[model samples]
Target: MTETRHPMTGNEMSPESAGGMERHAYDVVVVGAGGAGLRAAIAAHDAGARVAVVCKSLLGKAHTVMAEGGIAAAMGNRWPEDNWEVHFRDTMRGGKMLNHWRMAQLHAQQAPERVMELEDWGALFDRTDDGLISQRDFGGHRYARLAHVGDRTGLEMIRTLQQRTVQLGIDVFMELTVTDLFQDDGRISGAFGYWRETGRFVLFEAPAVILATGGIGKSFKVTSNSWEYTGDGHALALRAGASLINMEFVQFHPTGMVWPPSVKGLLVTESVRGDGGVLKNSEGTRFMFDYIPDFFRAETADTEEEADRWYDDKKNNRRPPELLPRDEVARAINSEIKAGRGTPHGGIYLDIASRRTPEFIRKRLPSMYHQFKELADVDITAEPMEIGPTCHYVMGGVEVDPDTQESAVTGLYAVGECSGGMHGSNRLGGNSLGDLLVFGKLAGEAATAYATGLGRARPAVAEDDLRAASHSAVAPFEVEGGDNPYAIQSDLQQSMNDLVGIIRTAGELERSLVEIEALKERARSMAVEGHRQYNPGWHLALDLRNMLLVSESIARAALAREESRGGHTRDDFPQTDHEVWGRKNLVVSLDAAGTGVELSERPLPEMPDELKKYFDEPRKES
Candidate 1:
């Protein structure tokens, strides 16, 4: 074996037995190649930073591509009355007033510009009759606000961002998994990981690291997320001394496929409803009218006729209850299923076929049309879809500075779904894509500024820390008669799905914590039979560490928040407590021993008196 010295740290490094080793140095190292990551890389590179984007999956395959609806922005192309202040109010109210005020303000104000920027970079969104980028209505928005390309807006976004990154010559390291973030003197030093194909060790020596690794949906048994979203970014940030908030508020998108065991939990985008689809019970009754909450009753239509008329004459009628915030919709569906009013396959019906003609459905929702036809042998254009809530997004993530996107740990930044406080208790549909663009650019710029300010002198990765990361990566292969990682993962998913899922209770959450601990114990001796190369079992074993930590955080946070608000619904504490739980958010961090997590309460920042006026009176749109 040949020993080589790291140029920056002067540390002796040798290839581990499992695979060859490679080292790279950059000013900013970005983890995850999703929309947020690519957008960040572009911003950093444009700012003249030597940036590298590392992802577990190939370029263009990030979870962002799975987004079907549209990017939320107050472009006002479709609704002349729509603007940033209204958008901000909708976001804050949609999140149950738990969102970071400054973040929400920035997001709503900047989102329109970001969407326009994408158009300048070659994104081809569907246009309106007058020939401007068309906006579509979605949950929680007062106007048609989402700038989209039919039901494949996310695909267009990734394509546009990826193209921009390539044109800028930013280096992208695809199919690489980052297992650990190394910090020196409480600041980010670099990141360590391995190539997925060969399992060869790779080191990124950088002054700044930005995590945009999407959500924790894969931790649930039923989810719209792909396998790559194992909560790596959340767990990595926590272990690196950053804190996470809102972990309990997991968004179960109200419409996931609930038929054909093979395709259960697949996303049925809210755009279906935005484009006129309606939900019905097995009795063919539009049940959303019966479930409209008092809070939304002022704006939501209580009658089916008014709801249907509002689609064409928004100025005259209240919006449909079907377009309520995701949390409300998901809970309503869960209640319907529990009451035995569900379809034969155990879900409610989303019927656009009856509301829209086949030609119109195909024109507006091409992807949903093909997705159902190809995956489940169902024709969405002809019949209603059997749909239920599925674990879709985690509003909780690494807590960061609202302006800079910098985490508690210096030189470490997080954006998009990996960062918290923006969405609060729940996120509005279409706002996610907007958050990625607005904050992705902000994080990239801030990280670049921090990195370049360090000049030639930068923090160095410790040799011992590097060795420990390598050992942890290979430990599963050396264990004797150890536990199965897949089995542990399966049990953890089931426990989370049944206990800490869409609705929660103190008893169930406490039980979930116990189960998580038990799984963590089993994971200690997780074993794999094959060599690191092409070993999925080993990959899963490694991912289990992240999933366990995130799971614990979610359960612990869920138990701490005793009030039902937004995505966190508790049967024991069913009412929102404005004086207590609503005033603060539970923040999670690694305990002193670094073996477990500890929770603390952080007070929500007050919104300025000027901005507060937007919510003081309800303005009727004309």
Candidate 2:
């Protein structure tokens, strides 16, 4: 495709017109109104600091609401033998031990409390007969560790936080998308963004900033994430000189709907498998038994009877191979498909219809039933669902202290999927919600404490910077003639999916870089026709900036790793290069290239003996 330049004019507020800008000062500014952002705002408010929660979307509709799997926590309900140590081990093993030990430990220890706090705040989760929150088994968890409210755990969690936030009267700036972080004297002062409703620039000057802006799945062709998962926080933090870690590890969900070209690939939630669904190829074979590693061999079932029995009695029988960690399941399906065992649709069938009755399927997997019926025109109740892998979560993000949730950039903090080293290379299913709750609270507490210690020295928000950022954010719409933003976005997604997806080789990574550069050039000339109210064109244009930045980071980091581990697999360098690569993390920073964004390496924090003790062996059932 030829690159086209569109004639454009700046929105009335150019940098030259605004001589000086007015600043609104707050003690803390939390960017992103998702679960982490809301939690941070509430914590900051409770810590006696004036706080503001800024989001690009409506208050209740942040990407957190889209999460379907349950939150992982060691609540010790059904299995009294389970504890934080076992949870910690499972997390590390699932992540391929690339995770920071302390972070994993802290997350496991605090997750139960965080889930309980959500319950206290009026969040209703499906309950056990004993009246505690109900738990279910998810991939990578040794026990039934995920506390859930059916499959809509994130909806319940976010709604509870949103309602609680309203009651607390925390200042919320909804429909405002933060374009840039304004820094003063090497510390983060605040952020500057534009209002999508009015196309006006708003300035927030605060001592502390929390980035909970979620994941980067939108950069790929297919994803489980919503439009908001554009790596905004990651991009903004990178531009402001914060270090990002583990950009190479992107998780490909094992079951996204395949076939329709228009709806593309929509995520079929993993909760289906958690509820007893099995993955089968067209030949009707239980394929995962062929892919089990020696490490998991003892626990995984090889026969249908054993698998069914395991579900009923997890303690006495072997676990189902279908419930292996996401990475394992994805690779198994990939292998089967590659060997010509795939269905006619170029994907395998996830059959829950045969395992359970239609009534049971409808009640348990309601969203799955609804999504397939509405989008794919298939009722999962009678027929097996066609599913395949799609890019989903990034195990890597801005590196932070496991205890404080403070990034290397003194005044900047990150929580949720934007922060790295928690899940390491491959995240365990159901653990993401728990990670958000645990670290969101930590980040909020840390930011509030940092703000409190600073007294009241709010820095100035420069008019020139605000105007420049606002124009950059809205420039795509101003382009009168050029490639459509949606077109460029689709191209970018395809490039990422084709070249930088599930399996990577050096040649493909090189091709992806070239393709990305060309796509980015096209993005600069993108045009939009609609006015700004709920304009998807405007949203895609803004999201493209984040997607480009994150995609580049992922490709560069993947190129540097030179080894296969967890979510990052190299066709050429097929083995894990632990001798050189294991000791250090591939850290991407803006300073390394003199372009204000750079990539380098940093040593992983040494695991203390206290924390390492948990990894001695898999917890034995007493």
Candidate 3:
């Protein structure tokens, strides 16, 4: 509530003697300015709460802006028969039914209205011939269900949300990274972070804090994620006493650019296939047909002719196997590369230019046309793209109550990719955008209601706790000699990539645990040079803690879930054990001593008979 001078610079800032933080007070504090954070802030403000959104990056640079696919919503625009019930079935089956049925139902039921809300707030979606929002085809969905822009849906979505937040007068704190969440009497009250530019500490005092800080993809070497995807929220939630569920389920998207080393792991949107792209091996074979699993056989096309025809007549013919869920596609690609059926690079070929008209290709996927033409010498309208599987998303995150999106920690709510349960073992394409909108709104409203009920009584921050957090943050700079932070980070990435990647074995996972322990030790002793002002090394040092903790949790959880399911593939245990594992959720939490992670089993809630009835009946067709 008061401002003072920095200790070293004597510049006007929060004083060092009293925690040295520029304190801010809000009813709801939302972290990360991505789709979820922005949406949450908007919802909170609309619900009559004082709201603020904080992020470590500039407003538009969040990972959500890099999204290429559309927002999945069963709006019945392209397919009038498409409805929420059908959407719910697709989502549950796509998730392999590992989701909290209530969460999946809420998302499916609310996503349509959320998308329409974006339109009402000024998002100009691509339209159909009848002037309705045009929906496109995506894997695992029965209807053409994704409402997108021309390969830039994320850009448009972020732009709209950002505009809405600004128009509603929500405060934004850009380039600030929170290191620890503060609790008072077992309730989440505030957070401790510092400015990315100056490294001066900042404190946010709020009744509710929304953890929308996204996922942990940066821990993998070949990932489509940006630098900010360090699992900050996941680690913060764990440290603040919230459990993580399904930590082993990390999604490896099948179509990532693989030609040039520089562009490796860059995402190739699913919209390419939605608009009629095909996958091929060096032998000119549509390999997806051979890789189709028995689970999806009834719904997928068996031949290339039928697959091609289904694109035009989806109602009568089954969809292509290329439209199978991401886990299946990624595994198929990995197998092809391992079996020597890959292209010149260690990836397979995705040929769209050979099939679609150049004009249509340019219109439907403008960004892809440019990205391929500029990055690689190949023209997407005339040549195939070198594509492979890449680490894209983690379906695991802070476990929350399905109804409120509130974590076990009373005032700490999580949504978007940072919150678990909505997308079970693996997420379907286009679902991420919809998930953000639906849950972000719910979390925002819930957090607001909780904050309002708390009244004018502010949660107190202990001086000892603030001092300890401050000391720990600055300790890296004090060490005279230690391991380099960047080296440790790079090593952690390689470890996850090689050992805990798409295909895993018992031996490999065991080795990964040993390696992760060493990495954590190195991170703990890592030192940084230079004063705190805009120092990349110091920033890396702070981020290392969260990354290591999250990586360790992922490896530990992966090792324990000994079954091959959606994204967590176990070579030794090659089948999904529904009898045992399916009935339980692998919950990850800090040990009572806060010294290490503890894994436990909790029974998954049974789906209500009313909702279960939909799945037992014949698949819904409009």
> Top model by lDDT, which number?
1
Q: Is candidate 2 or candidate 3 better by TM-score?
A: 3
What candidate 2 gets wrong by more than 4 Å, as runs, is 1-23, 474-483, 524-538, 591-597, 618-622
The 10-residue segment of model 1 with minimum total lDDT is 9-18
> What TM-score number comes out for model 2?
0.92
Model 1 agreement with the true structure over 392-414: per-residue lDDT tens digits: 99999999999999999999999
Query: How big is the positional error of residue 176 in model 2, measured in Å on the Cα after superposition?
Result: 1.1
**TM-scores of all predicted structures:** 0.97, 0.92, 0.97
Please give, for residues 1-622, the per-residue lDDT of candidate 3 as tens digits. Answer: 6866434323343344366467767799999999999998999999999888999899888899767879999999988888898889889888888988898899889999999999999999999999999999998888899999999999999999998887876788888999999999989889889999988888788879999999999999999999999999999999999999989999999999997999899999999988999999999998899998988888888988888888766755488988899999999989999999999988999999887999999999999999999999889998899999999999999999998899999899999999999888989999899999999999999999999888878687788988999999999988878999999999999999999999999899989889988988877788899998989889989888888888988999999998988899999999999999888889999888675688998898899999998879875322
As for model 2, its CA RMSD to the true structure in angstroms is: 6.0
Off by over 4 Å in 3: 1-20, 620-622
Model 1 residue 355 lDDT score: 85
lDDT of all predictions, in order shown? 0.92, 0.83, 0.89
lDDT of 1 at 92: 97
Which sections of candidate 1 miss by over 4 Å? Answer: 1-20
**Over the stretch 214-303, how does candidate 2's per-residue lDDT look in tens digits?**
999988877878888889989888888888999999998888888675655677788898889999998998788888876688777878
